[model samples]
Target chain A: MKNQLTVILAILLFFGTAGFSFAVKPGEQLSDPKLEQRARTISKGLRCVVCQNQSIDDSDAELAGDMRKLVRERILAGDSDQQVKDFMVERYGNFVLMKPPLAVNTLGLWLSPVLFILIGVGLFWHVSRRKPQTKKPIDTDETEHRLEEVLNKMKKN
Target chain B: MKIQPIKFLPVIILLGIGIAFAFGLRNDPSKLASTMINKPWPDFTLERVIADQPAFSREDLHGKISLVNVFGSWCAACVQEHPMLMRLANREGVIIYGIDWRDTAEAGSAWLEKYGNPYRKVGLDANSRLAIDLGVTGAPETFLVDKNAQIRFKVVGPIDEKIWTEQLKPMIQLLQNET
Candidate 1:
């Protein structure tokens, strides 16, 4: 029982810290919860230009914080979510978007998964088709014939 | 010993992957292409860092080939690139404007005093309003604007002597020749 309690406490501590680490500071959040939520959602889709991999919402970089504030400000100014995203894309290009839009440049990136799947299926089919030929089962009649000949030789001996 | 094209597929794929990685590894991920290139410079009105100087705006850049430099007193790389900018403005007679990005007016003024000021006009960008519009990720970025007020080229990091002589010099000369 003590061991189980300790394990539970350890898991709670791990998850509690994880959640606390990624949260935006109270000072930066908007007064209206709905607008703040919208800002959070929008920020999650923006790539932090300095951090490269982290979304603006998840980054502690000063630039990301400023971007988060900008998102809220835009939201307050009656800009739709799409408009906010477009605004960022206009300034920083599509690289600012965490989810890259389907466009001429990103066609290869979007289609590569399907291409890979088709290639994988083709290889599997080719291998399976050749497998049966190499591992052909012995004929029952041949096995029986060989057994009978062995029995006859034993009888003669 | 059958010479089958299919047998070479693995080798070809391996060689292709190796070549891709070789080139990809050499690429600097931090270097982002500015979307504002060839686009008109974003509109902004900024107060002058120095009290006596007039404010800076897009109007100042009109009919001129100018270098707009973004620097911060807090940024170490900007310190490293200051002498090169001084040479360009003082020696080579380049018209350079300044944006003291994400810094206090007091700090910006003090920094200019320490490092010899090389700007025709200096604007304070305490809130990064202009920096964001220019797609600036960090400090020590420089933009070359043509006579038409279009941003022609951008350098992300600190510019050194090699970049000035090789890339920016020829580009500036080319833009100057254009009507």
Candidate 2:
């Protein structure tokens, strides 16, 4: 019974993790492991034209499959990673890249996080400066005297 | 109570975000700006899709203003746009060249025969190699090439009467007048 349960759990786990596997079919894989790895890396960086959000490596679209093949073809042809990316950009524009290059058009997008953090820090400083301290220092002697009076009253009661 | 301008900041931010979303919702995400605009046609030598029709090459586009239409026999949208293309070819006398994208030559030739062939010449792009170079995302995409072979404009979807009368016809005339 335990063995059967383990087998079932293992099957479930395999099916659960299957969606995260690379979309590269066995036939599409290169003969050389090194070239295949390079192809995968390049595919992960390119956005599928038909399915805009998913990378070519993750997309099941026909265009994505074709793009993956093209990536491997370019690599086999001795084109460098940058050259492959440039080749895609020449046809599909910079939109084909998963992460767009930092250029004049993308300056605002690249700098926005730093801009937001600086704004937050400036707000923190300004608010802290404007806040008046409300906490008063306690006088130990007065507290002790009040405590003594309270003790005497309690004793009389 | 005197209204403090700072107190309305939430409302202002809400209004800004609402406006931004309204504009974003109006725009279609699938439509991308053409990268081939103002660039010369990419080089390709393609075989004739049909035995009777003439074959087309990149060099053929250089001497005339013409429309390069990417289509596939399997695509339903291509069928839907076939009538408009026929009208344009017959009535407007627009020179149209076809790229039968990602389809078998037999299928493409049959499709052209079934729907009245509107193309002056049809190129068979069985592997979609030429289509990819042309940056074709889907079938039935059309490009307006000037006399110099520079791609002037691209229409993503099927061109209707409005697009033809308002945009493409005027552009064609303008290009023809250019000395």
Candidate whose DockQ is highest: 1
DockQ of 2: 0.52
- DockQ values per model: 0.61, 0.52
TM-score of 1: 0.88
Worst 10 residues of 2 chain A by lDDT: A119-128
After TM-score superposition, the amount by which residue A132's alpha carbon in candidate 1 deviates from its true location, in angstroms, is: 3.7
Question: lDDT by residue for model 1 over A1-157, one digit each (tens)?
Answer: 9999999999999989986566488899999999998998999999999999999999988878888888888999999999999999999999999999999999988998998788779878877777444666889999999999999999999
RMSD vs true structure, all candidates: 6.0, 7.7
- lDDT (tens digit, per residue) of candidate 1 on B36-131: 999999999887898888867899899999999999899999999999999999999999999998888889889999998999999998777888
Please tell me what DockQ candidate 1 reaches: 0.61
Give the 10-residue window scoring lowest on summed lDDT in candidate 2 chain B.
B4-13
List chain B TM-scores, each candidate. 0.93, 0.93
